[model samples]
Target: MNEYDIKDTIAALATAYSKSALAVIRMSGSKALQIASKICFYANNENKNIENFEHRKSYYALIKDENNIPIDELIVLSTLAPNTFTSEDTIEFISHGSIIVIDSLMKLIIKNGARSANKGEFTYRAYINGRIGISEAEAIHDLIDSSNKLMAEASIYKMRGRLTREIDKLRENIKNSLMIVYGELDFPEDDTESFSYNKLIEIFIQIKNDIENILSNSKRVESLINGIKVAILGKVNAGKSSIFNMILENERAIVSNIAGTTRDFLSESIYIENIPFYFMDTAGFHKKADNDIELEGIERAKKCAYESDIILAVFDNSCNANDDDINLIEFLNTLNNKNIIYIINKNDEDKKFNYKIESGNIISISTKTKEGRETLMQALKNHTSDSDIYIFNKESYVNNREKSFLEMGLKQIDICIEKSISSFSLDEIAEEMNILNNIIGNVSGKIDAEEVINEIFANFCIGK
Candidate 1:
């Protein structure tokens, strides 16, 4: 009786609705084949015999309206239940990519008894029917939304059950530990020796360590999936905008000889070595502001630098180091967590600004001649190549949702460790272990909830 009843047939255009070479429309449900038979006929103008169609075989068919008017010619692939993505009787129509044709075919199919599929309904059905777990579903969404090759690779790894296997292994270890505790509590008189408190502590510690290891690269993974933010910071007329333009390979920022040309920050994203980097060009830093606008811009620039993962501190080589340059260096020194790269711009001119940071990667370049562009790019790539970002061999990376659950499970394990060491109540420890198991179940989709299902699938595009 619900709107999303799994028993009802659903249809949706799986590909982009544009004029292209071809597009695909997917239909799945118990009556998917029956509905296909109603709207589709063989290329020879004979009625489609659903009984004779082989599973997973493509048949050239002509879609027609109820009045027997031709709609479009498409190849329909029919798949029987329990073997398809949705584990239901499914049909996929590979039709020419025309908006009119797609719309007409969809309408004719819907008219013949299939309802429109909601966003991610196909994947949702797969999840509901035990074809894929929640983590795999999330991975599918991430794969679709991935902006870079590394992100896509990571998503594919998770989608292929790497994360699920890891979680399952963890859950098995926890459950085994819980069994020992439960056995001692339920049968204290058995010949089997009781689980030693020290051994229990050791087991919980190992589990805790395992969880911490899993979460170690979560932040870096998040950055890779989103992007690493790089802020360009320097004094006025230090060629910060020029460097920004060079990196973007476009004249995105206004370059001028006059100071304070960039009154605000501009952000753009590009991929370097398959890694996404978001570059921010902020207004130049100055000790003395000409007006409120310049002062606000300076403050904003400082804020941008503080928030960025990496900072490009530019110094003008055409002029002598002044109070503004000194101030910029002092500010950079305050940022202990930032990866600061010192760039001396305007190397084409006579070298007058000689001040340098005590230690850091410094490069002298002339943005006018486009020199040192490759060096700068390599430097950026080097920073991102750190152990956290370049970890391709990692089994899995947890998203925010999974990370939260892992943290909760870790906290619960710590509690179990404490109780096992100090408390005599094995029941109490078992209770905590049970809670940890539930948390793990949430991540692995062994325990399902309607709200969690809705939230996860809501991010997926329609027809996924």
Candidate 2:
């Protein structure tokens, strides 16, 4: 068996820690069948040698103690090697649902030399064993952990190999391109073996287009995994805090009409139209000649505006859109490419004559009356898309390492494609493509191939 196979039989209580109608104790490895047979009394199960797990199917049996005192009447499933989740021997005990009961059964399995698994371990093993790729592994975990229907659907699609199919197709394109590049590199002077300069240009251009598509789709992918990061920005007392509080429905920020009420940035994760979002309520921007604390908040607000997934620009409709607000809006105008929504707050006041704004450019709302807040929330949900579906709504990457790897791959491929278009250096292009492939594969630590299957399976819950 490949390294993905756990040499010793492994088992875990696959159900959640809480009470339920049923609990499944799952076991897999070379000795899984032996362990199951010892507790189950069925047709010659103890004396007769069983065929592959599937050939033995589920048998109505009495799960008894070592002394044959019946513990429970249950159904058992045995899936033989090469057909199971790990592509190894596996069996599942459909037993009573109590956590105590599941825990006892798991302890028994360990007593018989079957070790318990860990978080994300099962999906990890599946990837290691070739039952699935890294993408599939990630999807299954996402499917299991999905908090909403959209997330569930996305994860299920990914588990069914949706993202893998797209990525694999991309990989196939790169591979085919690699062959052409290497051929050209090997026969730099031969006309037939090398691609025509025009042909090379066309192929490189096509790959560039495809990579761009990947990056574009990746936007939806990241949105699906990590909901958009929307930074609510404006000067202090522009009702930025009130707007945030109204949207949250529970006062998350201190809202006072007093200027400089909010001296720092505040953030919260909220769901709008089932889309998860990280909403940051920022301090009012402007006046470097101010309280040091408030100024620091102003600086952070600007930083968030630049880096945020979406910029929620607030201007007071109750008063003139101040020059400060104009400056912020104008600066944001430079980022015409960013996803931004103008929230014109405090509509109850007089329509200011001086601060002119295109009404169409913003959602006019009165935070005191809780008006137009729903529109603002809908705006947030409108941009939330399915990323890897299962993993995050948007770039829901858990760590910087994963981010760095993807960034590296993106940059390298981007540069290589740029140069390939100009110089048509097949060697340089092929090198970059290969490096990209390695970076993607290494995202799950699969390149080394010796990481124990248990290490990966341990990442999963026992039931999975």
Candidate 3:
């Protein structure tokens, strides 16, 4: 995992191994073409197609075993050298999606020259060959693992070099200022302009402002990548499970009339207007548990509310508000800065509960008739406004490690700014700029390439 040996040919099943119409077995390295040349023959003749091998072209060939008996007919594609995914001689065999065929082909490949690829070895080769940067490599992983449209879109933006362009711009501006500072230090008596403490502080302020913007907008970026966690809490038999089922338009949670039917929380991911929303249905909260199991459920519900970004306080409309409902109301009032939506379930029934909650968001919905579904969706959409969705100038951002690098760079800049106001020399300012530059380099995988590349590709699937 620490190092990748691109010199040895690596092969793996690129496509899924399940039953399908086609599967792809990929190999990349110096001996890829040689191995393919040995095992592959023309479909109509016994002549090997290796002599006529062309890069970026596909040829229908028959793969034969050691006994010269044809094993399978497949399409072999080749991409040579300095213009491939791994920047090496790469060959891919597109064959029928059969486990026996794939296993046979891989065994033949290893027998010929290639070794079985490790997890993300192909992508690691791509990274070392300069085909992609660290952010784009991580973005590729995100793109593959994205669960919703918003997450995919954000990954696309990052993979297309939007973030790299911005980071490069920041580094360019910093380098420009460093050049000026160095010029002043190397030739103080020449025609070069010597900057005062206040003047240098002015320039550093802009860089600090840029870093601060990225740091402050991290939450919005995170919401797009990993959707918001929403918890549903109410008293026993308050139709919390009913509401949970209604929102997903499927019978994901079991709904029953008996109180204390659900003793654990259930979570589901649903998209509302392209925004991913993770909804959790927790066990009902009550004054005192009848048993230890119910008590454990109540404790879990409290934990869910503590970790959620939004809370849906469901209420029953068929009966009057009891002591448990009032206690639930009092508990919700203690949560500050949490988006609480008071949902009155069973709106079709005769309303006997006249409850007043401090929360502004309130809606009445009947789970049986599916009423107020659109209204609730719109309310959720309205909660995530345009500014809340995209707080920064860009649409995507780096991962947690890169965010840490940005924060470290911010701290270094802050130090430079504070020192600029004092009797600090140009040499000291330049030294701080060097440290800031190294931080940015770390963010882009220029420095500490092994750790960054390992972290990025370690999670990727094989043959990526």
Best by lDDT: 1
Ranking by lDDT: 1, 3, 2
Which run of 10 residues does model 2 get worst, by summed lDDT?
393-402
Runs in model 1 deviating more than 4 A are 45-50, 191-194, 288-291, 386-390, 446-448
What TM-score would each prediction reach against the true structure? Answer: 0.92, 0.77, 0.90
lDDT, candidate 1, equals 0.86
Q: lDDT per prediction? A: 0.86, 0.68, 0.84
* Model 1, residue 374: C-alpha shift (Å): 3.2
RMSD of each: 2.4, 5.0, 2.8
lDDT of 1 by residue, 1-464 (tens): 15458989999999998899999999999878888877778888556544455687999888888877888888999889899999999999999999999999899888889999988889988988999998999999989988778789889999988888888988999999988887888787883565588888888898998888777766677677677899999998899999999999999998998878899999999999878899999998988898999999999999998889899999999999999999999888788788888999999999999675699999988898989888999999987766765565576778878888999998888888888879658888888899999997788686556777777877888888
When summed lDDT is taken over every stretch of 10 residues in candidate 3, the lowest stretch is 389-398
**For residues 1-464, what per-residue lDDT tens digits would candidate 3 score against the true structure?**
43577778999999998888899999999998889989999898866555556889998899998878777898999999989988989999999998889989999999998899988888778878898777888888889998777778888888877777778878988898898888788777884455567777887888888777766676677765587788999999999999899889999998888888889999998888777788899998989889899989988998989888888899999999998899888898788888888899899999978877654799999999989888887877776878876553365676888889998998999999887888687788899988998897777657565565666677999889
TM-score of 2: 0.77
CA-RMSD of model 3: 2.8
Q: Give candidate 3 misplaced runs (Cα > 4 Å).
A: 1-3, 191-194, 287-292, 320-322, 388-394, 449-452
